[model samples]
Target: MKQMQIYAFDMNCVSHINHGMWTHPRDTSLQYTDLDYWVDFARTAERGKLDGIFLADVVGVYDVYKGSAAPVIETGAQIPVNDPLMPISAMAYATRHLGFGVTANTTYEAPYLLARRMSTLDHLTKGRIGWNIVTGYLDSAARAMGFEKLPEHDARYDAAEEYLEILYKLWEGSWDDDAVLADRARAIFADASKVRAVRHNGTYYKMEGIHLAQPSPQRTPLLFQAGSSARGQDFAARHAECVFIATPNPQAARPIVGALRCKAEAFGRGANALRVLGLITIVVGRSEKEARDKLEDYRRHASVEASLAHYSASTGVDFSKYSLDEPIEQRSTNANQSALAAITKEASKPVTLRGIIDQMVLGSRMRPIVGSAEQVADRLAEWVSDAGVDGFNLARTVAPESLRDFVDLVVPVLQERRLFKADYAEGPLRQKLFGGRGRLPSSHPAAAFRT
Candidate 1:
């Protein structure tokens, strides 16, 4: 029996992965800027024994809908978004075992700055930090960064490869584990000889400096990536300890999971090197009727147009151009190719605009599991046994209430079956998730840079 893990999916905005659920009268996402709301949310997830809280972020607004940002703005698709990294320290302070996996794109920011920012969070959280590596999928983000258009998709991944190499050198090679002496008698703060500058003149980046910060509890934060495309999977196989897979069903997930593991083995990282977490949304209740009714209630707040607007931005195809019944064709996109694949060849059949709308029952295309606690637990176990997923990345439907329900209703059922952790294991996020080891395994590519 494999143990299943869970992470709460969210963002620092009103609407995250779910399109327009912010309209739900009970949703507290409107208070995204409020610290009290975040602290409480973090505390709730910790109480639920969730593995972590993974924050989704985007640097630019969703403007692909009708070639205007109006619908996204009106529905608050993902606009009014704040930096995802800002709330981690506060959230970490409010909880003990919960981890934070923050999304940051490699295309927009300098690696030096990102490496340090992540290190600072790792220090603050005492090593309960993971980085969700992404390459920007929106052209609007490119414009915000002063580019005429987004870089070619594969080219972006190419740059990311170099970026990670530099990060490894800085985080793993620049400082020795015993470099921090903090000895007052000899007035020595750190051993100078144990630290050295990292020099890299790669095609995409050039830097020659010692790491800005000393090594935190985990010299490198646990690496996470969610790219289901061929090029993306190759990068993930080499770098990510955990991979996020978004599919409509367990049948769609098994091959992706198996391939990722096989690719990791090909890279000499061993077959179990990568842990695949499927994207799932749960709407649980004390009774089956209660869950069904709750799902209908949430459906009433769903906005198909808002979902289309978000989909347009994600796949870089304007839904406004296609008729409701028109079939969508596969085209080359610099945006999220995997998202497009999910509805096209990757799906059981071709999906059209109407099909897309029909799928947005919970404000998005992700299939939701609605049932009593026992039923939800059984389905989760089935996913683990059948889909070959190590865990789940739970999308948020309604704010605190959705999370609160899972904690109060579903967690006990999973624990009772011994499929979920009742108590958190003691250590940094990496150790808790992968075992008692507090650092990256020697088989990981980043370990090659270690001193």
Candidate 2:
């Protein structure tokens, strides 16, 4: 049996994927600003032997729901968000093996500057880093950056391709494997000849510079892509090592996973070139009834309106305009096409306003797996077998408590069943997740730029 990888989905805000759960009395996600909160989170995840804590981020508010940001602000749905990159060093200092997958939008920042920042983080975390590549999904983010609207969906992906190519040159081509000499007697710090400046005159960007930082343990951090659109999957096929997907259930997940693997194979990469992780939420307790009771408790506080607000931002469609019974019509938006597809094309039923509310348990549309430890383990194994996924990115119902329960109760059962690892594999994140290799494989596009 293949051991499954697990990552905890989180964000640096009071509310993340689970929109209204921050209002839960016990939820401490608002402590997101404090370094101790992240340090504690890293420690707990490491204790559970989780593969990584993937932090999702958004630069704009969910104003699309009601033509204003008020609903989002009033409900505290993913607003007042902090920078995901800032907490990494502190969290890295606190844990040994837990990887940090920080979200950074390639749509806004320049490739050269972003490359330096990631390399610096790679050095700080000792290569325990992965980048969740996203092109900004919200129009507000574009306006904030002085653009009237975001670049067209496919157009953004085009820019990202060029952006990634430049990054590859800087990270893998510019610095030779042994550019740093540190010769004491000869008084030479580096072999200048071994380091070369990269020049890119691409359609979207122009650059001529050597990477500011020296090569880290992993020249390129592990690449994690969450694009679920058709073009998005093509990008993932060529670039991503791990792919994050949002499917509503196992029935929906199987075909999507198959399609992504097929696309990867078509791109000349192996069928298993990408590791697919589906998004899910779990609610566990000592007894099945206890878990159900806890589910009811969490559901009581979940705000359906906040859930709609979140969905509105991701798909660029406001549920507010439609009647409760009205059927949703999916349209092309500047936002995430994959997000919309998850509800419409991927789901077994048509998405409606009232139907959308019914899906919100603990403030998100992802249906929760509620059971005892043994039952939860069985369900997870079944998901791996039936859905053809490597693992899950588990969303939170409460704060550390949800994660704490999983680590304490669910992890032990998984380890006992040989579905989860007791001890972490030694090496950088890429090695631990894929194999004992700290860099992208030869099949990956980034490797083509290697010196």
Candidate 3:
């Protein structure tokens, strides 16, 4: 079996995808404000020989449920979040070979500004940065940014397509490879003629300028996207080098992965060019009983209200409006349409409020693996073989504790079986993952814009 890539799935907040797990006695997520927390995390990931840490983010609060923010704020449901990009530099400084995949929505941010920020980080981290492109899904985010409501779902992806064109022009085409001429006699840091301006006038954006910064190590940061809708999947097919997906089971994930690969091939990309990673949470211990006990202990801290608030925001449905046994009626709203669609359309069975709560019992709908290290590794291998997934984005149940358990217990077993890396690879995140050059491959659509 091929070695699997693992990223420490997380967010820069008191609570992330798991919702109310911050109250867990062992969770240190509340220390998100402290720089040391991130630094320590980076070190721990490196020690585990993990590929990277994927940090999820949102620009605004979750105010879709009850049409207000109080539920989110009161339960700490991603409301007290810090900027995802803030702690990354410190984390990079603390560890070598640990990539950072940080999420930033393209809807509200200017392309040039975001490009510069990513380039700066690429330079600082020596090309270990990956950007998870997201179109803002929250109506609250739109309102906060002065819009009446969020743009239609497909329209956002359309806008993102144009956004990527502009970014690619800046990142890959504006400056020639040999543009930088650091010669004292010439007194020229860069040859201006070698750098050209990028001009674009599209339905969503218009820009006429050269790239603001000199090219970093990797001209373009590693491209990642998490969109499971038809339009979203199409967008990922065109531009995403890595794709994130979430499903209730590996059986469910298999067809989605197949469809995504087919879509990528339809867009003239290699079927295997894009790597699909599934979100999963595991609670492994020396024995199955210990793992179950740990899960129960963690459940004592799970906040039902917080989980509901998170679900409400993500699906644009207010769980507070429904009783526990109510069958969740599917309706369109202005949040993560794909997520909502998955629960409603794709599921083999109907999803109910109780079902949702049960799913969140261990943080999201990902199947949990419990038992010894060998048992956990065997399950992961089975998922890889059966689902055709590239790897797993392991979510933390309790802060560093969940991560620590995986590293100390499961990693050794995986390494022993030769299913994971025992040492860091010498390159940027892309090279580390793909075992090729650090930049986007020439076959990628973004590479077509290169000068």
Judging by lDDT against the true structure, name the best candidate: 1
Could you give candidate 2's per-residue lDDT for residues 179-222 as a string of tens digits? 99999999998999999999999789998999998998888999
How far out, in Å, is residue 321 in model 1? 1.4
Give me the overall lDDT of model 1.
0.91
Q: In candidate 1, what are the lDDT values of residues 323-419, reduced to their tens digit?
A: 9899888887788998887777766777889888888888888879999999999999999999899999999999989999999999998899899
* Runs in model 2 lying further than 4 Å from the true structure: 344-349
Best-to-worst TM-score order: 1, 2, 3
Consecutive 10-residue window with the lowest summed lDDT within model 3: 360-369
RMSD of 1: 1.0
Q: List the residue pairs that clash in candidate 1.
A: none
Q: All candidates' TM-scores?
A: 0.98, 0.98, 0.97
lDDT of candidate 2 at residue 231, scale 0 to 100: 92
- Minimum summed lDDT over a 10-residue window in model 2 is located at 342-351
- 1-451 in candidate 3: lDDT tens per residue? 9888889998888877766688877788888899989999999999999989999998888776677889789878777888899899999988889999999999999998999999999999999999999998887788889988889988998899999999999999999999999988979889989999999999999989988889998889999999988888999988998899988678878988999999989888889888999888888888888988887887777777776777788898987788888888889786788778877876668888888878767555554777778888988998789888889898888888989999999999999999998898898888988878798887888889987
TM-score of 2: 0.98
